[model samples]
Target: MPTEYHDLSNWDIGFAALLIIVNGVISVALKLGLEKKLIVASIRTITQLSLLGFILEWIFQQNNWFYLFLIILFMTLTAGYTSSKNATRFYSGMWINSIFAVMVSSWLVTSIALLTVIRPETWKENPAQFVIPLLGMILGNTLNGISLGINYLNESLINNRGRVEMLLTLGATRWEAARDSVQSAVKSGMIPILNTMSVVGLVSLPGMMTGQILAGVPPLSAVKYQIVIMFLIASGTALGTIIAVVLGYRKLFNSDHQFLYERIQKR
Candidate 1:
């Protein structure tokens, strides 16, 4: 194992942060698009990271189960917020769906991966410090997939109402009629992830691997962790997206198996 490198304290974080402001200014002067977005993003990132840094320090000190539960609750809320942002009004109760999907898929995959794969004797020792980041990334990626599935399902059911009606007329079940649509939506949503898999090492180094290496974990172990996380992400993405798609389909269809195109409304 490599020795811990805590050299960043000597470096001026403020000076590095100033570069972001400079870039935003340059963007405005050059008429580049999204200057406002860049400014907002920089501010939000700073604020959130700062707050989370303090929370993490406190969490490390306490190391209590209640704090762990709070972390999970916050993750759920964040996943739901992201899902709700892109979700249609037609998909009522989508927050509930998002929470359930992220929680179930993340925990299922993480538990299995930990127990059967890593098998750390004391699982709870650094769960908040370690597992939470992995779960957050998984929840975030899964939310992206769920957004795609929900949007695609809504548009398809709206555009192909005639087909849906015809299926209903022919006694086809709601699930049967919309199965292909949901599947396609899921595939489309997951395409970026598939592409990421192909370029994981060649194009980019993931955060888990980078952080582990920086914190003195062996390169081989970091690589393994990265690979496991990517697989777990894929698993959670599929599960969460499927859940959203299925629940959204149920919401789109009614007792008579008819398409509810009229129900979708802009909020």
Candidate 2:
């Protein structure tokens, strides 16, 4: 098979943009009041992706470890902030906990994959290609997991406040009182990735594999890459969800086995 694929021209992209008009038309016809949001989202997607393309191109050329590190740090910080902000409820120092969870989980998984699975020849000198994309993918999924976990945990605790307090009053430890909520939150966070994994090839071809195939990669090779990506996402999501929930649990419950319900606040 040829290792080359046709490059997309500006006209091709412009034509593709026309597909958004279908969404706009639907919004107008249904009176969904989503036209403005659709326009804004479309504009942001084009602008952000374009900017990222240029920045990634430059970074790829530079091959400097420092620049790569800065980019990774910036991406991780942004992911953390976004994750925390997506939660409908708030708690004291939740942002810090979210950031810590996302950073630790995504970074750990990405590092292991890079070091062991996709070890490049110039890994120490330049690992931008593998690190950037893998970390970004992991962080993106992990962010969702963290946000979902936090939201679910908050809602569960608030809704089951009486039950939890009753358990606590019955000599239950804080962990015992909040165990159900924590487990449920973690499960909720992991649901998306789990569902995706369950129906990946049957329902749809994931973007990574599709892109690789479009770029002329052998089908089996693309499938392998996608498999690795799915595992990485799953690992990152699970780790991040567990860590964020545990941290939130600790924050909501004191060492003295008391539930500090007051610490949780509405956003």
Candidate 3:
């Protein structure tokens, strides 16, 4: 195991400013036009993470399942809302489904992992710490997958409407007609997790592992935790994407089994 890691001091962060200066200089030299956004993003990152750190500390101190669950709900809703913004541009009535899908899938996967695979003594005992962070991570990735996959599905449906209609007219079911689009969209959502898994430990040290090792955990223990986190993310992303895409595909068609092309257009 590694020795206790050195904690960052106020002075330590000054070094990070140099990286920001370098980035800003490059942006100016190349006219990348990202300086303002970069600065704003940096500020937001610091503010949000600092706030979250305090909030998590409070929740940890409380040691109450209710507070933990409430935080989880907030995380789920926030993630759902963020992803919904991406999807709402292409379809109506999607935000609600996105929220529902994310809330359900994230909670389900988080619960399963907490209850079975990574079971703690009880919610109040030893698992709340594990539950919140793991759930947040799963929800974040799931949100990305659902948003990207839904966009892909929407675009696929629009681009291949004629082919879909031909299949529909040839006695194909709605599911059959939209099969390719669904598959493509689902694949799009799942690819990130898959790629990450493929390259984990080889190409990169995952955030969880890096954080754990930096916190002085044994490498093998951190690896085990990272493995659990990765699998949980994959499961949550898959379930969320499948639910969102299936629900989203249904919205692309009407009650009469006809493709509602206009639904794919901005409302």
Candidate 4:
């Protein structure tokens, strides 16, 4: 069994980065015009991840709950705004609603996991180690789910405006009129995670498990951690998608059984 993990040096990292040239070469050969975008993306990845590494290292060293809370809040808010931008449609205060939905879902799942499943010794005193990574994973997946959900909801409402109005005119309640769209939107958001869960270990090794294995953790232990992460992601995605879709539904309808289709504007 491998007991010690290899520590990558700067030279090793530079060598690995050279792999991006393969992509640049392909783009140039095919006249795809993606070389510039690839270069920009590579630079951004290096800069953002390097800064995040330093910030996280400092936060871990301090072990202060206030700093941790502030970091988590910032991450959640950023995720909310990012998710809102995925929608091609716009409504007033959509960003605020996205933020609230993501914040609530990610925080709830992370808190549950910390308190129950992976209660590290210094969890209460210094949760930075566990909380940061776990919340980040959940938040990332939840952002995708929320984005997909909102986009689908908006598009569905716009495309089926006539059907929705017909149902409303037929004396159906708002919920009844929008039920199909709401269900479809929620399902669309969940489909990615559901597909991932279905073929996780069989089809591909997930990032957390692969990282742990590379760091010399026992395979079984890494698998357990990966399992926990998958469950947390699933829960967070479901909650975020449901909340976002429900909120959007309410926004596009009124208690008087009227469809407020005018509020949804295509961007």
Candidate 5:
């Protein structure tokens, strides 16, 4: 049998961190004034991932579906809250819409893929190990799309107010007046995923495939999993972006079909 992949020692890991020092150097030379932000980000990255490692280890040892579902709920809530930060303060309802959108898209796509394509028999045995990580992947991608869509939609409404108001004055329906902005917002959110799809293999190796290879999985097997995940991520992101943008734009108008500019949160 092939030997299992070796683990990294702390000393070896520290050597890998030299790149961060290089980043700090660049920041200083460029006068970017981002040393504090960089340091905080690096620290947060280590702390969060270290904690997640322990959490996943414990979850993997449990057979209780309730705990698994609770993790999913926490993930969905946190994703929604984080994404909502990108929205204008006026749109308090964005959190509800974002949560719903991310949950529906990510859960649907991730569950279907897990049950259908991946089909690890381990799921029926200890599902948390398989489901939680996969759900995280789906939610993470969907969160980005939702946040970007909300940000774009909010900005578009503000910047294109004149055009939208003129359309309404000319007897255009609310939907018609806002169709362009909604479409633009959705497109903005989907662009990153689209670009990744276009250049995935050519530009860079994706995280899952690279990590699996490092962990001693066969490259071809890792590639197949990566392909399936890319499909899930793309579909989930598109669905979430469309749903969030549609719901978000509605909140910008009232029952009279009049724009609610007053609802816009002041910067």
Candidate 6:
């Protein structure tokens, strides 16, 4: 933030575009069709982030608690929408469940970090700098993990409906019948975070702590902050993915244990 103001520095812009193309090229070279994903991703990202940039500028000016609440609400809403688009194999009109899961789970993690842990002395001082970004990170990760979890959850549930039916006939509750698949999906989603934690120090430092260190925050302080973020993400992902599947289970079947699959509007 050197008085020159570096919202999107030239270096960042160059690297971002370069990375996008390189990703696409590498994928196509390896027969992964990373090219198409990169192309579509570029347009979608540019349009969405442009709109968000304007909204955030205004949001920062209105830094009241309710405003913060509204901003989080908006993020939840958008993420829910896209996540649902990707989750059509499991449900329709599912933004509600995702919202519910993200609300309770991410907020619990974020609140513990901001209020109980960091205990920032004043909101106005760091609203844009720390809190918003951290909240965004938590919410974004929760959305991805939970949606990915439920996508696989639905597939497993449909495939193993016979097991579920058998369990139900044996008097298992609705929740119990689906517990195994739900647990499996949640575990799958959480493995990424667990794997990252296993190699955090030896393999690669995370951007949050690394950036902080580059900016001159003491190594110990940066490490502590990064640890808090990692823990919060792990906790948030676990809670979000679990709750999403629990709530999402309702969408997967009729009272007779039938599946409800649908298509999305194509984001």
Each candidate structure's count of clashing pairs = 0, 0, 0, 0, 0, 0
Regions of model 2 farther than 4 Å from truth:
22-35, 122-125
Query: Model 6, range 1-267, lDDT digits (tens) per residue?
Result: 223223557688778789888888889889986688789989898888888888777777766778777777777777766555576464565677877888888878887887778776855474655567788878877888887887778778767867887888887777788878888988887888888889998999999887777776778888998888889988998898888877777766558744443421223
Q: Summing lDDT over every window of 10 consecutive residues in candidate 2, give the lowest-scoring window.
A: 118-127
How well does each candidate superpose onto the true structure, as a TM-score?
Answer: 0.89, 0.94, 0.92, 0.96, 0.90, 0.75
lDDT of 5 by residue, 64-146 (tens): 88888999999988997788775654376778989999999999998898778878674788888788878888899899999
Model 1, position 249, has a per-residue lDDT of 76
Model 3: per-residue Cα lDDT over 1-267, one tens digit each: 489977998677778967997999999999999999889998998899989989888988888878987888888888987776866347877888888889889999988888787766655474567888888899999999999888889888988999999999998888889999999999999999999999999999999899989989999999998998899999999999999999998888866778888877753
- 124-212 per-residue lDDT for model 2 (tens digits): 66678789989999999999999999999999999999999999999999999999999999999999999999999999999999998
Model 2 residue 1 CA deviation in Å: 2.9
The candidate scoring highest on TM-score is 4
Prediction 1 global C-alpha lDDT: 0.78
Winner on lDDT between 3 and 5 is 3
Please provide, for model 4 over 19-125, each residue's C-alpha lDDT reduced to its tens digit, 9 standing for 90 to 100: 88888999999999999999999999989999999999999999998999999999999999999996899788888889999999999999999988987664767
Candidate 4 global TM-score: 0.96
lDDT of 6 at 173: 75
Model 1 CA lDDT for position 129: 70
How would you encode candidate 1's per-residue C-alpha lDDT over 118-233 as one tens digit per residue?
Answer: 67665657767766776788887888887787777777777777887788788899877777787887887787788889999999998779988988888998898898889988
All candidates' lDDT scores?
0.78, 0.93, 0.87, 0.93, 0.86, 0.76
The deviation in Å at residue 58 for candidate 6 is: 5.1
Give the clashing pairs for model 4. Answer: none
Off by more than 4 A, model 5: 1-3, 18-39, 88-90, 120-122
RMSD in Å for model 5: 2.3
